[model samples]
Target: MASNDMIVAIAGGSGFIGAAIARRLAHAGHLVRILTRNPDRVRDRFDFPNVDLFRADVTDPSSLRIPLAGAHAIIDTVQFDGYPVENHRRGLTFERIDFGGTNALLDACDDQRIQRFIYVSGAAADAYSPHPGFRAKGNAERSIRNSGLPFTIFRPSLVYGPGDRVLTMFARILKLSPVFVMPGSGQQKLQPVLVNDLAQCVELALGGRGLNGSFEIGGPDPLTFDALIKLMMEVTKRHRAVVHAPAALMNITGAIAESLPHPIFSRDAATFVLADSLCDNSALLAEFGITLTPASIGLRYLAEGS
Candidate 1:
C-alpha cells in the first residue's frame, strides 16, 4: 500500500486507461484527484474510496490551475475523442490534444508542489515519424523529458482489458459476423498489455526509487494481428473465418470514415493496424519486478458469461 498522504492528480482520469490507474492508486491508499471536463457526469462512475473528481479540461489552460493545485504527482493519460481518427475541424487532432494539452499541464505544474510526472505514451511514438499520432506522442515525450522534472514515461504496446475499445470491438464483430474482416494483411505484429498490468506499473513507479526513465511495456508474447484475432476467437469461443481486407481499400474506407460526426476508423487507423508494435519488456520487468499477463490468459474475460 502507498502512503495515505500522497495526492496523485490524473489529467484524463475519466477515460479508460486513466480510470484504471486512478482506481489502483486510490485503492492502495493514495488520494486520487480525477481531472476532467465533466465531473458531474462521471461523478457516479468513480464511487470508490479516496477518489475525487475535479472539473478541468487540458485544452483549457485556465481550468487546469485549480484542479492541479498542490498535487504531489501528475499522471497524464489524456487522449482526445475518436482517437486515432483526427477530426481537424473539431480541433481534435494529435497536436492540439496530446501535445498541446500536455504542454498546458506542464505549464500548470510550474508553481505547484509536483514531485513527479508520468506520461502514458504509445510504442510507435517517434517525433520524426510520418504518422500524426506517433509524432504527437513523440513531441509530448520530448517535452516531458526536457521539463527537468523526475518522470517515468511508459510507451505501452496495444493495451487490452475490460472497457478497452479495440479488442472489445473485435469481440463484438466476431459475435455478429461469420467472417471477420481484418484490416490490411493481418500480419502486423503486436505485444498487447493488460490495462491492469499497466496500472500496476504506474503504481510501482510511484513507489520505487531511482526509477526515472522511459519503459517499453508489453505482454509476455508478441504475435501477429491474425494470431491475436485467433486467440480472441478461442477465448470468446467464437470461431469466424478471417478475411483480410487490402490496405489500399481500407485506407479509402478509413478516409471516408473521417467525415462522420464520430469516426470509428480513419486512414491513420488503418496505418496503425498495419504497423508493428513489438517491444522488449525486460526493462519494465527488471524495474517494476512485475510478471506480465499473457494475452491467452488475460483475454479470458471475453469468454465469461458466454
Candidate 2:
C-alpha cells in the first residue's frame, strides 16, 4: 500500500473495467484492494504494487464487512455471468445476484463510514423490466439509492476496451456465424463507451468529495445496433453476412439459449439492445473536466490488447 493513502476497494476488480479502475487508482497513489471470488484465477493479472487481492463473494454479506470496514471508497462492479443464475435454496434468478447481492454489499457498506460509493450500472438500466438481468440491475440501483449512502451511480453504455467481453463476444459471433444476427432491425441507438472513460468517471466521483449522485455516460457518437455490428465487422475485417433477427425469433432463441449451460445471448439483452442505450455524458464530462474517449479509439486498444 502507498504511504498514508486512502483505501479504495473494488468488487470484481479482476475483470476488465474493474482491473482498469484498480490500476488507475493505484497510479493515483491510493491503496487499492481487489475483491473477487477466484483469487488464484486473477493472481497474476494485476501487478500494481499498491493493489491487494482478497477473496470475497458479494452474495455473502458477512464476508464483506472486514474488507470494507475502513475503506475510503468502494466500487460495485459485480456481474452475474451466464443467462440463468440458479438459486436452489430460493429458486433465485439473475436478479438475486444483481439486486440481492448488491443489497448485501450495501448492508456491508452500511457497516462502514466510507466517504464515497461508486456503482457501475448499465445504460439499459434506465428502463428496466421483469427480465432477470435488467430487473436485477434496476433493483441494484434502487437498493443503493435506498441505502442512503453517499454514492455515485454511473450508468455507462456498452463498455468496451482492450479486455472487454462485449466486443470479444461480438468478435466471436462474427467469427463463428457466417450470417451475423442483429436484433429488431438493429436500429436501436447504442453509445458504446470505453472502459477507461467509465473508470475515470468512477475516479472523478471518488475525488469529487462525496458529490453523491447519478450520471448517465455514453460514447462520443451514437450508433445503431446494426451499425455497431457493421463497425465491428469493419474493425476486425470480417465480412460475414449480417442477418437481422426478428424480435419474436430472438425471444425463442434467447429462451433456448437460457436453457443451455452458458448461453452467450440473453433474451433480456436482446430486448434491451432493441431499446435505445444512448446517454448524454455532458454532466459526467463537466464533472470530470475532460472529454470522453470515443469507443472507436478504444477499439484500437482492443486490437492490440487482444
lDDT of 2 at 224: 89
Q: Which residue window of length 10 is worst by lDDT in model 2? A: 82-91
**Per-prediction count of colliding residue pairs?**
0, 0
Summing lDDT over every window of 10 consecutive residues in candidate 1, give the lowest-scoring window: 203-212
Off by over 4 Å in 1: 1-4, 260-262
How much does candidate 2 score in TM-score? 0.89
Error of 2 at 140 (Å): 2.3
Candidate 2, pairs of clashing residues? none
Q: If scored against the real structure, what TM-score would every candidate get?
A: 0.96, 0.89
For candidate 2, the lDDT comes to: 0.77
Who wins the lDDT comparison?
A: 1
Q: Which digits, one per residue and each the tens of the lDDT, describe model 1 over residues 1-306? A: 344568999999999999999999999999999998899988987988999899998899999988888888899999998888888878999999999999999999899877789999999999999999999999999999888888899999999888888888899999988999987888899999999999998988788632568899998999999999999999988999989999999999998998888787899988988899989888888888889999999998888734
**Residue 303 lDDT in model 1?**
84
lDDT of 2 by residue, 162-236 (tens): 777767878888777788877788888989988887877777777773276778889989988887778777777
